[model samples]
Target: MRNPLSDKVISIEPSGIRKFFDIVSEMKDAISLGVGEPDFDTPWHIRDEGIYSLEKGRTFYTSNAGLKELKVEICKYLKRRVGLDYDYNLETLVTVGGSEAIDLALRAMINPGDEVLIPQPSYVSYLPCTVLADGVPVVIELKAENQFKLTRQELLDGITPKTKILILPFPNNPTGAIMTREELKEIVEVVIEKDIFVITDEIYSELSYSGNHVSIAEFPGMKERTILINGFSKAYAMTGWRLGYAVGPKEIIEQMIKIHQFAIMCAPTTSQYAAVEALKNGDEDVAAMREAYDQRRRFLVNAFKEMKLECFEPFGAFYVFPCIREFGMTSDEFATRLLKEEKVAVVPGTAFGSCGEGFLRISYAYSLENLKLALERINRFVERLRAEKCN
Candidate 1:
């Protein structure tokens, strides 16, 4: 009998993050700081809108691009927040989630053997999605000294004649690193000069702890060449709602919508209505949640500092990538031992990419109480390791 699975799919490994999440689920008293999800409940008004949509029997499929109202709101939110303008009718597409938008963008643009520049220690999906899309995945290893921000030289180094796209994952996932406008200007120059397109995933835009988040699309000559992807999941605590959107040159978005149409038909109608509420009036809720996340972020940074651990301060998203090379263990080994001995679970940084070795990604999305308890366990584990090294 012939093998049923596609060889391409078989070559890809499953998500490394999921393994620890599954293990911690069944372990008694285990605490996980691995998942990058908000702890806040969806704001009441947003939930109310979804409920109201259902009560009004608005369950029918929306247009393939999504509800016109939601798309317009997304454009408005982008213009108001990031100063980037997009045409709602032709340039925007609502997706099942930001992950789907990522996949859609890759599939829409990639041709076989086209090179895609992917910065390492990024969200795991970008690399594999490029592979599945038949794009060559060129990894750009971001440096710890540079705070993991992709530099102009790094971008240039990754580009070649066949380079077609650059996946810009700012307010990055595992590192929580954000690219400021100054930093982004350098990258924008490289992208324009190289004549390569960009897929900038700004899903964590509102979670920025430093200054306001900046979008590469805001720069001159960039909007035409950039696909901007964002969603309500991180900012509005609407992860389970399964809604996200993309905005780009209409030509690219048209292709993405075509894929979304055949594959998903439409994003959830109720979620669309709720997201409208989120964009229109959920600013205060986002601000409150962001403030809470900022607090937790600071607490984690300081905890690592007091433990004498080496961790760079991350100014965006809700995670900290702390170096664990002092322990002389690979990220996987250290994380495994911590889980086995202390019942504290954190994702090995290698889950993001190979360059993430000797580091761990610890999310700060949990409550203060849980973070405090988990930190205590981690501190104990670290102290024990230090003592053994001295002996």
Candidate 2:
């Protein structure tokens, strides 16, 4: 018998984030701040739309590119909310989720051995998708001194002759760092000169604090070079519905659509109907969630500060990455100790990148009550560690 496995499949480790989630599942009394998902249920109105679709017997496939009205509404929402103007016909491709959009965009454009520039301490999918797409992932680490924002210098440093794509995941995950318009302008200058393609994952755009979210599409000469990925999941608490969309240059989007068509014919029929409702009627729900999340974000930051654990205040996503070096433990060790001793679940920052070694990421997506309890548990854990140090 042959020991058969694809060489590409052999090189990657299983997802680090999944390991902790699985562990927490078996442990009773675990309070998990590890998962990246929103705690809110899918809003009643949105759920009702899907249920209504089924009763109407509209249970067939949508157009492979997705419903025309949904794509039109996506264009309108982007313009109204985020200042990104996209063409519904020529520039957009509806995907199964932002995950599949990432995969399809990479598959459509990546030639083998081409380098894909990704900022570290980002969502985990980008690296693995780059590898699976037969593209080389060159990670540029985002730094604490920079508030985990990727600098233009860092962007330039990662580029070489073979570099083909740059993924911009602002209003970022894990670190919660967001880039400003001036910062994005600095990056756009280099990217335009190099003629490099960009994949901008703006799924968390609505959840931003301090300012309205800006899009790379707003930059001069960038709409042609940028692929914009946003979805129903993060913004509308619709993760389980599995709907996302991408918009970019027609040539690129058309190629992605080809890949999407062959692999998956259409997004879910009910999800398409529900997503249309979300884009239409769900803005209020999003605003309410963002308001609640901002409070949790404030609470989590103060908890870290009270413990004397150094942390940069996060601006966008519902996570805080706090330095754990004071504990004199590796990120994994700190995480393991927290889970075992206090029954609290937080992700090791190293799960995001090599540079995340001295940190831990805690999600603020839970309710105020659960967050209060988690913080109390964290306080008790930290006090015990201090007493142990004194002894």
Candidate 3:
């Protein structure tokens, strides 16, 4: 038989986060703090809107870009929240999820041999999406000393004549690092000087525990060259709804919409209607959930501190990336041992990138009760590890 698989596809490994999550799912009495999913149900009013949409038979495919009303609402939400303005009709393309927007933006923007600068300890999809788009993935290792925020020097070092797109995964996953407005201004200068576009994934925008989430696109001269990707998943707790959107220059957005048009047709119609409701009337629900996540975030930070674990206080997202190097084990080895010995599951930081070695990403998206129970196990595990080292 002839060979059928693409070498490129075969070369890609599966997600390391899912590897542990699947194992924990099968293990009895195991608790997983690995996945970044929120514990909240989709807000009640949003669910009601979806049900109402179905009852009204609003089941047809929306325009490839999305429903006009939803697009307008997304624009309003962005402007109101982030101080960025975009034309709903000309600059926005609704996608199946923020994941799809990441993929679509890469496919639309990259040509073969183009280089994409990806900051490490970010969401897993960026590097692979660049590869699938036939672009070279240049990894920029973010320093823990800098709280994992990409710096101007680091961005400048990553750029080359071939560098075209920079994937800015701020309010970052796994690391929970966020760039302030001042920090972003430094990056903005480098990007403008280097003439590189950016795909800024801000899916966790509202989950930011620091001040308001700042997008690189919020900087002057950025909106035109930046594809801002966000969705209802992190903030609105609508992960399963499979809804997200991208906003950028009309030229770039038109290209993304073309890919989305043929591949996805449109985002789910009912989810679109529900998201409209979410944008219009779900602020209070989001605020309540944000408050809960903030409490859990603080609890995890304090728990790690009390355990004598070396962890930087992360200011965004519901994860804590604590250093596990003192245990004298690689991140994978430590995570594996913890799961096997204590039935407590967390992701190895290396899953995000090699730069994440010696760290583990523990999500606090679960309830306080679950977090407390898991922390007890984690503390016990750390005590045991320290005793072993002394021996």
Candidate 4:
């Protein structure tokens, strides 16, 4: 048989976070802080809604754009939470997950050789999805000094004639960074000046610890040019439900819906129903979960500080990016040694991008008990490394 894999597909790397997770899975008594998933179960009310839908025989596929009721709920939620108004009929698309919405958005907008500027360290999917869409992925290395927030200068530097899309991954995954409204205005100015489009991934929007999450789509002249992707996974602990939505200009949403119609048909009907309940009646559930994550976030940051590790205080998301450069080892080496010696798993920063070197992303989505135990093991490992260096 001939070599049959597409070169583009062959060239793409698997997610770095998953690699460590697989190793941790087989190890006995291992504690994994590698994955970004929430530890909380789908809230009872949300799960009950899905169960109710199934019991009522609503298992059939919804319209390709999604159930009208679900879309309305999504719009209402966006308006109530993010302060943005969207047309449920013409400007929204339901997707398999936030991941699929991102892929579809790139597919809908990217032409061959179009450049998509992606900020790092971010979620693992953006670069691969951009490549699969036949777009060039240009990475903007965000600095820890800036709290991993993208700067206007970096945005300006990354733009070129071929640049067509800028991915704003805020309330970032591995680094837990968020861009303030003032910071976004500066970026919006650059985007408008350069005449480029943006795909803002705000899946973690509800998890912002500093304040209410702000969407760039709320800025003047941005809603027309920005594709906003969000879902219930992070917020409602519905990761397995695989429901997400994209809201943007009608022109863009129509194209995304076309791709979604043919490729996915529609999101899971039960999930859509569950999501409706989540949007309508799950605010208290979301608030309660956010509070738990906030507590864990503070605990992990303080733990890292007490260990004398240089950790940037992350105000959003459930992960902490702590610098391990003081140990005179690469991030991958440190993570590997810690996992092997202490049975504690964390993802190396390089998993997100090269700029993540010398850092490790420890997810605090686990319980306080798990986090405390993991931190104890991590502190011990660090001290052992120090003692070895002295010896």
Candidate 5:
């Protein structure tokens, strides 16, 4: 038998987060704050619309570009929520999820061996997708002391003539750091000077605690060069629906559509209909969820403070990355021991990147009772680590 695996695909590591999840799932009394998804169900009104659409026999393949209605609604939603505007007719394309939008953007942009600058301790997909597209991933480590935000100098240092794309993973995963307009402006200056094409993953845009999100697209000369990736998953509790979208220049959208048309004919049709309703009437759902998450965010941050773990308060996403270096354990060893010894499931920070070593990513998407229990167990576990070190 011949092995026909693509070396590029086989070389990449599997999602580090899910491996621990499988082991933790079998534990009798485990509390999982490992996965990065909202605990809320998709809102009733939106779910009803999907059921209605199915009952009405709206089950055929939508246009390769997606339903016109959904794109129009996305246009309206982005403008209302993020203060970033895109022309629905020409600039937007619905995707299977933010994942597909990311792949499509990379495939549409990268030539073989072109370098894509990716900030570390961010999402897992960006680096793999770049490799699969035959693009080289140039990793830029966004450090904790810098609030996990990529600095302008780091961006400038990584650019070369071969640099073809930059994936801006902010309101970031695992760390939850976001850039204010002024902060993004510093990077924007370098972007404009080098004319770097950007893919900004704003999936967590609606979850920001301190203030509103500011899109790089809103910055001068950026709209034409930035592809904005957002979706119904995190914001609307619709992860299973698999509905997300990308908005950018029409030329790029058309190119991405060609790749999407061949690889995936369309995003699921019913999800698109539900998404239209979500766009129209889901602000309240987002606000309510954000408020609850803010409470959990505060609770968990305070827990870490009480435990004396070194961590920065997250701004947007439902995750808190706490440094466990004081425990004298690698992230994997600490997370593994915690799961078996105390039965609390949190992802190792190293799952995000090498820079994520010596930390753990704890999501706050569980019930208050569950969160409290996990916090108690985590505190005990940390004390145990300290006690072990003393011996």
Candidate 6:
């Protein structure tokens, strides 16, 4: 038989994070900090709304863009939380997850060989998605000295005539970095000058520990050129709901919706009703969960410090990117050995990008008790490794 697979699919590696997660799943007594999922359950009120929708026999499909009420609520939530106003009817399209919104946006915007500038040590999806969309993936390796935030110089260096889009993964995964308003202004200047569009993934916006999460879309002239992707998963503890949305200029949103229409039809009808409830009445729930995550974040940062490990202070997302270069092991070697020796699981930084080879991403989304235990095991493992090196 002739070969039938697209070389693109064959060449792309599976998610590196999931490799350890799968092993951890089969091991008893293993504490996994590998996955970036919230430990909290979907708030009672949100779950109740989904059940209520089902009880009312409202399980039919929604419009291609999604339920009008849900889209309205998403717009309202954005306005109230991030201070950006978008037209619900024309500017927003619901997606299966922020993941799908990313894929759709890339497919909608990218012509073959169009260059997509992606910052490294970001969420793992950006590069692969760009490649699958037939765009060239240009990586900007963010530095730890800058707290892994993308720099304007780096942005300029990555751009060329073919550059069409920049994937802004902030409150970044694997390396919890966030771009401030002032910092975003510098980047906006570059984007405007370059005439390139931006796809900003703000899924972790609500989880920010800083004063407030600022969206690039809030910058002047940016809203028109930016595709803002967010979802219920991180903030509302609704990962299983698989619901996300993207908002942008009407023209781009309409094109994305066409792709979404044929590929997904709409986000889950039941989940849409529940998300409306989440946006309207779940502020207190989000606040409480954010508080808990903040506490855990602090604990993990301090624990790493006490162990003499170099962990940058991450203010946005739940993951901490700690430099493990001192141990003189590859990120994969360190993570694999740690999991085997300590029965604890954390993702290797290399899973995010090649630039992450000297680091490890430990998630603090677990309970304080689980985090404490995992920290203890990790400390012991580090001590043993150091001792062996000395001997």
lDDT of each: 0.95, 0.91, 0.93, 0.94, 0.91, 0.94
Worst 10 residues of 3 by lDDT: 207-216
Candidate 1 residue lDDT tens string, 201-233: 999999998889999999999999999999989
**Candidate 4: stretches off by over 4 Å:** none
Worst ten in a row by lDDT for model 2: 78-87
For all candidates, what are the clash counts?
Answer: 0, 0, 0, 0, 0, 0
lDDT winner between 3 and 6, please give it: 6
- Name model 6 segments beyond 4 Å from true: none
Candidate 1 lands at a TM-score of: 0.99
- As for TM-score, the candidate ahead, 3 or 5, is 3
* Model 6 per-residue lDDT tens digits across residues 221-332: 9999999999999999999999999999999999999999898889999999999999999999999999999999999899988999998899998999999998888999
TM-score per prediction, in order, is 0.99, 0.98, 0.99, 0.99, 0.98, 0.99
Model 4 misses residue 66 by how many Å?
0.5
Q: Per-residue lDDT for 290-371 in model 2, tens only?
A: 9999999998898888888799999998999988787788999888988998888999998988888898889999988888
Candidate 5 backbone clash number: 0
Deviation of model 1 at 139, angstroms: 0.3
Candidate 2 lDDT for residue 241:
93
> Model 3, range 197-271, lDDT digits (tens) per residue?
999999988988878888889888988899999999988999999999999999999999999988989999999
- Cα RMSDs of all predictions? 0.6, 1.1, 0.7, 0.7, 0.9, 0.6
Output candidate 2 Cα RMSD: 1.1
- Colliding pairs, model 4: none
User: What is the C-alpha local distance difference test score of candidate 3?
Assistant: 0.93
Sort the candidates on lDDT, descending order.
Answer: 1, 6, 4, 3, 5, 2
Model 6, residue 98: distance off in Å is 0.5
Q: Between the candidate structures 1 and 2, which one is better when assessed by TM-score?
A: 1
